[model samples]
Target: MDGSFENAAGQARARVALRWRRIGFSALVLGSCAALLGLMAATLFVEAPDPVGIAMLLLFALTLPWTTIGFWNAVIGFSLMTFCRDPAGLVAPHLRSIGGTEKIASSTALLICIRNEDTGRLQRNLGWMLEGLVASGESRWFHLYMLSDSNQAPIIEDEQRVAAELSARFGSALSITYRRREESSGFKAGNIRDFCERWGSLHQFAIVLDADSVMTPAAMLRLVRIMQVQPHIGILQTLVTGLPSASPFARIFQFGMRLGMRSYTLGAASWQGDCGPYWGHNAILRIAPFTEHCHLPVLPGKPPLGGHVLSHDQLEAVLMRRAGYEVRVLPEENGSWEENPPSLPEFIRRDLRWCQGNMQYFHFLSLPRLLPVSRCQLGLAIAMYLGAPAWLGLMTLGLLRQMPIRADLGALLFILTMVMSFAPKFATLADVLARSPLRQAYGGTARILVSAFLEMLFSMLIAPISAVAVTLFMLGLPFGREMGWSTQQRDAEGIPFALAARRLWLQTVLGFVFAVCFWRVVPGAVWLWAPFVLGLAGAIPLAMASADPRVGRALAAVGLCRIPEEARLPAEPEYATLFAPCAPLSPTGATE
Candidate 1:
């Protein structure tokens, strides 16, 4: 009776904590939006409102919430990381350490799903991952499955050849299997569901990996142990950091992302208790519940806007939670890694697909029996992509408002927004410098500071380009333009000038026009928007230079844009054997 009472009490306390968290988050977001919008409104009133000014005010109001949410997320996340308190501490205790390899007794299927990816790199990484598991003495606890969705004959042959070679090399030590589907109807989600339907009952859990994903065996083992200890949890996602890259753009973008993600995701995890995020890969899912409860239903709509759900990760988590299971994330946990797109165009192309996927969430938000936080996540994803267009519109309106806006107030607001958006980066830098090991890993405090400054400046330069590109893409989604899925390009190669121009001519034209207007009417104001204008005006060149491997190699040699992983490679022996070549796989699954 006492034990049951304690359980009930725990449940009641969790409910209270979640309630307070939601209330606090809501209040912060709403308050920030109101304050910013009020300031803009006051400015407009003093200027005397014309229709353009009023339109600017409305757009600013729409856009302020997006910034507000981001600002608070960073603030809350920074606080959480600094204070070192798990947000879900009172409600759920984290399984941080394990006793021994023997303790991780649950059987898990490590599923690596691929579709027209770099097969050679995939094979090499897979070998290392398997070797790492064996080295960690946890190979017996997991099985390996290479599930392919490639429709191309050459790609399928290559994948099978690689699979066969891997099996030949490690078959005695591991349970490895390869399967390819002819009809990849639903894309990745459909691929996963097909696997579940066939072999869902074989394993208690499944760890999903993308073609580019690489998780250390120790990390994989720890994740499974956490699941073993926590029966009610349906999925646990690790905060994946980008692997070492040779592309300057990849390095710059990934470094900033790695720095911010640790703190931001930590805060996100704490607030998102049972409804934590599931980034399609580098996550472990409870096979049975995910198989039974998380089957995705085709939404009632047409292509692009509806049809099969494109962004299925968050929706799956919501569905899992709806069936009385918990989804959690450990943002501080390391060892999960994935590669980034090598160039600007490739990056935007990936974002274009995600933009479509996220926009589709608008239909799912109204579904019955969904949790409030789940709904909030969907709304946030939508707002994330929508914010780009909103900012674009606001910028256009600001230019059109034509009143001599005070440089002082504009500068102040810019600083405020930049600070809110980037406080975590500075905090992360400070956190790194405060610790000797962290500082050394990043080539000391001096290097980190220089990198941060350069990264921030470069990121600012890219902001307008991304904003304009995404805005155009989002606008076209309504007109039945579908972003066709394709293999992600991960090589660092220069984008052709003509191709770059063709893709980004609209952005370039806008930049030229903005520069012409700003130069003619507001020459003094040019400095304020130079980064934005110059970045767009030189879009083709910037894209080319950023994607140049020569630039990336030069930057790395000088210790600029250095991440910890780059300086100190993983200790796994597989990394050492990576350069050793393997023979190609034949059509009949034999090394030719």
Candidate 2:
């Protein structure tokens, strides 16, 4: 047995080393492609005179600068040592160690309010985080509260079971509370309102957590300290690091996110300062400020047109700012983590809700309180991300028309945009390497390089899937069903037939449209459409990954499918010394 175990370990190490070598080689190949593309674009720009040529030239120019950025971000986006080079390094850690900060023990109750959530999965997430906190020596300083909205049969039982279990173990140190609701009057916001009115005065602050949210031990501490020192900060939300289950598509995505969009979020917040976008959950709030000043106003109207703010996060931030408290994002910690929709269908469903909320932003842009310079920065952030679809739309429409549009600067901007999009991932990866003991596990250098290439390939394929998904959701809004406060379903790769069909069909139509235009129009534009294509191709695999990866039956092993340039990729080690708190809760059957 000893001989066999040693042999296995030896094999793993060999594989990891080979993997890094592959990574280096892949990086060289990609770097060469980007450099050559940059040269081509630069040379073309100097010779353009015709309108069509100029437009293409401009487009190329816009793209090249970002190519450099995207390439660099890909290189270092996941830095291991910086405690997350993306956004957490910016604020969470800073607040954690700040001297004047006071610990608000029991004074603040961090609530993990839920509706129809799987108690087993909830316990797992809650367990991991709280354990990390206790191991880090913060068990006594905080209290955990859970609010449930399960009114139905099986769900209510599971929820009660979960609540009772948690209440039993940490009865005094931890508290689990559940509520079905007096009525569905205001939806989720109302459920929370009742909590505040009932127990609001007992605690100075209440950290609101969604069912899917997971926080690092330190992330929770920083939130409390920040609330303590910055008395006027009504909400200091962080840019979340979303982790999905497992599979080629899921792993690639969960990891790639920090690489791509996360940096932009970090940069946007850093550059803009006080005007960060509100992500709703995974944030801290003062009870007095929220209840007395931040209560949401009902917009006078009916279905889809009006009701309590569906996008309450944005409204909360705007209201907080209006009430003289600063609403900001602290990147210093990676305390709060959440789940990303593993597949395109779920992603679009989630986005539909956002679009409806954002559509309202267009209306509120003129509201002085809603769009004050600090708050207006929030709107501007919305437009910056939203511009992606519009920009893609332009590329599509322009090609279909065969109209001569200038692409000179536009091309450069778009290229730089891609770089900005991907570079953060590289930086984030580097950070990850610096921290994980899996340094040996992830392979030496070759594997990282190969993984990067495969990662990029997968990213491109998903692009079209996402673009069309976004477009479809936007179009479907007018006739869409009234989405409610739904719980995230957890199962081992269980995607119902109806949901799968709806997604596949929509993707097929969108891909065909883009493909036709790509063939008929300027062939160059198809590169920009990489987003949609990559996504559609990877849809099936992503769907499979969303189910619990631990369940073991993988549709396709993400590591095996790509990155053969390396031998073996690394896996995260269980750092037991780091987490010993959050002993499993006994759970209760009684409702609070």
Candidate 3:
């Protein structure tokens, strides 16, 4: 063989080796967690509970299985759904394609929500979308609105300045309104609700965008046209793909999310007109249904979690569905994108809120109005969020009792739960293969296959740490602190590897100690001894996007970029590009 051929083969082997290394590491971690959980299952007492213990266990029991089972199921089940070749969607398509129209027609409203945000970046994204909308000749029908929740008596001037500038720029064609109150309440939902009440009265519908989300002109109009046509649809949420930056972890996940989430999103969005959940971003909604039907109650309690639904989007979908409205995901739409958190710390901060909110779904699990598929989805979220702690608790109890690993119902559920969570990963693999172009995007099927083990390994490492975090939060809930609605960490500098490693050290230590303690007491199943301990120490950064430097090289070797390539857009000035292509909004001879 030629020396060049030999070198290339050697490099390929190295790639495969690195991928397996990560996978093995992950399996070790998961095996330990499952083993510990199995041990715990052997010890659960079926004895009658006193009122107090029964009440407490009632709270824990409802939440525990959902967390363990649901978490794993989403990861795995969604993975399978993504990979499957089935053409059926869970929801029926509501909007018909109106391709090749260049007329100034359909008047849709654009809603942009902001709260103490970087105005420049906000302006850039808004401009980006506006330019696209106008270029596509949909601007005449599309009015832009800047909804604000800035309430500083002092900095109020700056907020007003920005809003005023935006209004002046758009004039009567673009409507920009700002609502700054002394006391800001209800978070994003509150802000949006307030806007809907005031302006939702004016427009037919609005396409809502997160501060960082960049929606293309075509996507915005496509979403609006669909919502306009599908009157029963309260909110049309899309499957948001991550636009990763120049970071190791973000790039890999960008590919993972596209393949992992897109097909399932398509499947979920297609259910019997029963939209599973709206993610509150890059989706369009009719003004009347939302304003009239989407009033969020300030729940009685303080927040890490009181006073409102933490998972507001899911609950909103449920309420809408209950009120005889249609809520769903739009998979065929494109150009709506978001950036992944730059680091591990930021990632966890975002997840904690999800964990707390999804767990609250137990309160509505039995509601009769929701479709079976939607309910299954709600249940899935609960399981995914609470997975770690429940598994750990069962493991802890089993070791204390010195019992053999039970092969009964509980054990089966534990395994099934995990399979559901991760099944999505394998499915994602299958999805990439079916679509040949995405293979070019991901480097190659050759590389992707090699990378699966590393991906699996990443999952195993994060599970225990996540389990502990969820368990602590669940246990800590009686103290009555609500996890507040925190802004995500976007555009932040990445934490160094050494610092990130130290951050997880505490978790690693505790996981190891607990597993060892259990192994000493109940020495039978090696599964019991493997994952938890691995998970605990694996927190050093196995699954973390940026953890494996080899993965980083692999990503770069393929010319894969996470954030949207700027060259994809033209270099014309904002307004030049903004409305240049949008056929001049001919007066529809209609008044708003």
Candidate 4:
């Protein structure tokens, strides 16, 4: 009895310490942001005291902090990954001592949700995933369900055909089933809700997956074991990384993301604990809690912001936590994979959709029964999209305001801010070099360094254009411009030059205008603004070149960007020939 009391007291003390660490992290981010804003205010006041200048300063103060938050997140992540032991356990004490061999007493259903997705790719991935489970001899412990919200007739037909094929192949081996909805009312969230209302009671746990998602049987089993041990947890999200892509842009982009995400996820997990994130896919949920608590409410407004919440995952986490269940993320876990947009236009298109979804969070932040941390997370998501326009606005307003002096201090501060924002890339590189196996997997330190450098260059070039595009999308919202849901393009194929131009012309024009204005009206600042302008001006060509398979192949051959997953390829067969019969289907009948 005495030992039990002492253990409980020790656990309480550790929780207090963890809270202090999180508080310190928050202070570092907020305090640095405030200091940066003050410096910008001083610089603006010293230059021009006019209304435009004051507004510019105010906007700068508001926008600059978003970058600071990201900067500090990376910095803290780097520090933790480098120095800390038991990173996951540090955040949530319950997670620290979970028994690995916890018996899996709960029944789980593996769910795959789709909306007008490519049947062949879907079937291929499904087959491979099932094969993994069968190989692991855990197929009996899990049931597979294919849930579709595809509205198009031909696409639905294709889905049925693929279901027939999958049923034919795995009917005897596993319990596989399919269902399609005529109306994709609330999109993925609605599809899942339908499942919950009808079939959720049959299982104690559910593993949710997107159309492009794949996970190994061992990974799935680990997730289940964790849930079995930690019954208080409502959801457990995996740190999903991008699948291998042959496109140069995806190769470079995903490689950097894969490296950085490890550290960032660990740091975030340590802080978030029970108040963690849900990325909609590659996650497990406690069926009873989710069904009872996570039915999303219709925000009291019209379309977009007012109607059904588009960004439901984050809010669902909040609701689950409110209902006395923990929502969590496992950054150290593996065997989760998803596809990224293959090219720039596709990336922007996807970002636009997310931008609208995130922007809608403005309605829910003030909702009753919400946790303060959940509110902060929602605000941060809003700032992410808002920051882009804020940056663009700051630049445009700065260009217009008259400069009293050479603005040397402002220039220095800007450079420092840029460095802080980019520190994560460097930190990731440092981590790569520290691990010998990871370094060799990336083709040695020299190749890794080169890859990082190239990735940074291309990312900088891509950043401004994407920002401007997102800003425009946000602005279009009030005018009733909506982003409709559709199947995402996952291949890394080059788009037509004209199509690229059509998609990126606004950014090109904005870049050209900014360049000419700076050159004629503010020649001294042209050097500072040229990069942003050039990136936008050449957006079309850049997108095309980045998506070119030949370019991606060339870079890969030279070891510019290579992830370990590409080298290993999953052990499960690709089954390319099996998808051959479904190839001749029209694009209208299948997602590309």
The residue-level lDDT of candidate 3 at 454 comes to 58
Give the TM-scores of the predictions, in the order they appear: 0.93, 0.72, 0.74, 0.93
Q: Candidate 1, residues 317-407: lDDT per residue as tens digits? A: 8899988899988766368888888899898988989999888888888989998888888888888887788877877777666675656
Model 3 lDDT, residue 28, Cα: 47
Q: Can you write out model 2's per-residue Cα lDDT over 497-547, one digit (the tens) per residue?
A: 566666676665555666666666656776665566545544665554443
Report the lDDT tens digits of candidate 3 across residue range 165-228. 7667666655556666455577777777877776677777777777778777767766766665
Residue runs of model 2 more than 4 Å from their true location after superposition:
1-106, 128-141, 381-389, 404-414, 426-444, 478-482, 492-499, 523-592
* Model 3: residue 517 alpha-carbon error in angstroms: 3.2
Candidate number of the best lDDT = 1
lDDT for each candidate structure: 0.79, 0.57, 0.59, 0.79
**Candidate 3, which segments miss by more than 4 Å at Cα?**
1-91, 95-106, 151-173, 270-272, 359-384, 406-419, 496-505, 518-531, 538-554, 557-592
Question: What lDDT score is found at residue 275 in candidate 1?
Answer: 87
Per-residue lDDT tens digits of candidate 4, residues 238-297? 889877666777878888787677766666666666688999999999999999989987
Tell me the lDDT of candidate 4: 0.79
User: How much is 282 displaced in model 2, in angstroms?
Assistant: 2.1
Instruction: Compute the lDDT for candidate 1.
Output: 0.79
- Cα-based lDDT at residue 567, candidate 1: 43
Candidate 4's C-alpha runs over 4 A off are: 1-7, 92-99, 525-527, 569-592
